[model samples]
Target chain A: MTAVVTGDLPVIEAPRSRRSGGGNGTNFEMYAWIFMRMSGLLLVFLVLGHLFIMLLLDGGVQRINFGFVAGRWASPFWRTWDLAQLWLAQLHGTNGLRVIINDYAERDGTRFWLKMLLYTSSFLVLLLGTLVIFTFDPDITG
Target chain B: MQAPAGTLYRGREGMWSWVAHRVTGVLIFFFLFAHVLDTALVRVSPDSYNRIMDTYKTPLVNLMEVGLVGAVLFHALNGLRVMAIDFWEKGTRYQKQMTWAVLTVFVAVMVPATYRMVAHTFAELFGSTT
Candidate 1:
């Protein structure tokens, strides 16, 4: 190995968690931290129940169809349940991914662009999902 | 005696759990996007929605459903473990044990769930209707 110049060596930085003043003085990170755990707790129930009914009971995946969905959405409680799920899961996951992007994307430009794509996709998903849940017509074809 | 040079987080259960949580979280997020899109098909037409759902009923995809369930369950369990580490006073000290507990619970849930899913798949593939 050749001797390296001291000036050419990259500076070793501590990980984000160890840094005391990593964030921009705003409480955004703190809020993000809180949101993750809270939404995570809620999703444990909402998603598991959804999975159990749609993927495990009444013949599992085979029994699920448009009619199955229609039946579920027929009730206001189920509608509210789905709407809450859509919001919480989408926001929770979006924030989780945002943290990941912040951690991995070292370059400023790369981080900005990655977050743009993430935010865009997540926004569309939230919008589309909310619309579907609210405007779902069981007899659309009829 | 262990050397003090190497990082503690690397090659340890804590790092692995964090890594696993990240990976599964990313994957599940992508799946959620698709799930929303597909569910939106209900507003399109009944026949169109049902036709799209037929793809999910395939045996190959059925196996992936088992894997998805495993990933989801693991993520959920490990999230709780993370919370414990953050909130509980004894959490950091017992994090290794908590990691093991997470795996134990994951396996406990997955075993029976996997068996049930596999059995259902086989019956759907080979069972004859009388």
Candidate 2:
């Protein structure tokens, strides 16, 4: 560990540095790290709250039929809760993955393609999850 | 630690974490696809759907669910590690430390969830309250 002195304070520079010379401008990664901690904390609540409500409330797991889901989604509260959960979890997870891809993929082409694949799949899942929540029909008359 | 030609593989903590995340993500995607398809069976016929869900009561499905939850927990925790490495210049040095931290969190969160899942499956299978 090499320590760089900044005004009588010891600052350690991380090894395997990605700090390229010039024009790399801005601490976007720092902002992202902060975002993860914040989002992860929030996800702790949102995800747990969701699981509790869906799997534990009322008559517990037995009550989670199609009708129950439909009834809950009919309310704006559940819808918003679900929408927020969907967006936050997906964004947080995707951003986390993006950082992973950037850190590992050394080749320009490899990094680019891997990220492309990641983003594409994230978008598709988000779209499908949202669609299912919104367009779900409780009544299927037979 | 020699990497093959044109592999672009880095022998580092971050690299392994990335590989794991990608692998788990793909696995989760496949599980999600199968889950959605199975649930769609409900639209076909409720009786058949209940019969299908009966299969999930087996120990095999319970074990798979443990693996699925493990995957989700690992990917989420490792994703946080990657974020830390990217964001904090100081964090990159502690990559090995953070990798361990991620594993600790994964086990902590997943162990309980896996237990509950298995217990529920067992209760369903044998029809015993105790």
Candidate 3:
């Protein structure tokens, strides 16, 4: 039987409510937490740059009609940027919601259902978004 | 024994920081939701896409853009602070200092960005020669 002690501090076991089972050895939550911060930092730039260009440039939001979008998507650079933004934002928001659900939902069933809904919707949005970004056809006619 | 409910939160910077982070996170989520739908419009005809976007060209929306910038900036800086706390052993001890540093950087970044966003929008709407 190995001990749970670390240095001089008392060995505190993981909480029963924690789905992560930290005391059992998995570090999934730790990695998720780290991903949140890393993705958040990158999103700061990708999202801000997107907002600046789309909402505050020469013509501003007024100029962002179909033609403008079509013209922009014609370049692979914008497509990649948009795709990255879509994935990051969806994953970040979904994971945040998952954490909140785990923290707040008192019952196991409720928490499971809430996360199910969150995951389903997140998946749908990501799939739809990826499709739109890559399969956009600029020359479609009536 | 617990402090009274009214005074429970007194002198707690971490509590306020937690609140701010959650608020910003929610705000960003909603914005992204709408943004994805709007950008998906590009898959449709340009005319249809532009027609929808035409409504966004207003002073009110421009003001909201400033708010979005504030939320994003705060969330990003605080998120870095969170990372520090997670990875650095001394992070917990200096959390308050880190919070202040985050706020300082937020102000530094937002002030200029806000000025540019609002000023440029005003120039566009009212046609400033300068």
Candidate 2 error regions (>4 Å): A1-27, A55-63, A140-142, B1-58, B68-115, B127-130
Runs in model 3 deviating more than 4 A are: A1-27, B4-11, B120-130
The sequence of per-residue lDDT tens digits that candidate 3 reaches over residues A1-142 is 3334334554455766544433557778878987888788788789879877875677566566777778898999999999999999899998988887888899999999989988888888898899999899989653
In terms of lDDT, the poorest run of 10 residues in model 1 chain B is B1-10
Single out the weakest 10-residue window by summed lDDT for candidate 2 chain B: B1-10
Most accurate candidate by DockQ = 1
- What interface RMSD does each of the candidate structures achieve? 7.4, 9.1, 8.9
Consecutive 10-residue window with the lowest summed lDDT within model 2 chain A: A1-10
List the DockQ of the predictions in order.
Answer: 0.42, 0.11, 0.36
Q: Rank all candidate structures by their TM-score, best first, as comma-separated numbers.
A: 1, 3, 2
Better-scoring candidate (TM-score), 1 or 2: 1
TM-score value, chain A, candidate 3: 0.82
User: On residues B1-130, what C-alpha lDDT tens digit does candidate 1 reach at each position?
Assistant: 3333344466799999999999999989999999999988888899888988998888898898998898899999999999999999999988889999999999988898777776766876898551
The C-alpha TM-scores of every prediction are 0.89, 0.59, 0.80
Task: Report the lDDT tens digits of candidate 2 across residue range A1-142.
Answer: 3333334434446876665585468888778778777776676567656655643355344444555555787898987887787777777767866876787899999999999998898788787777766765656543
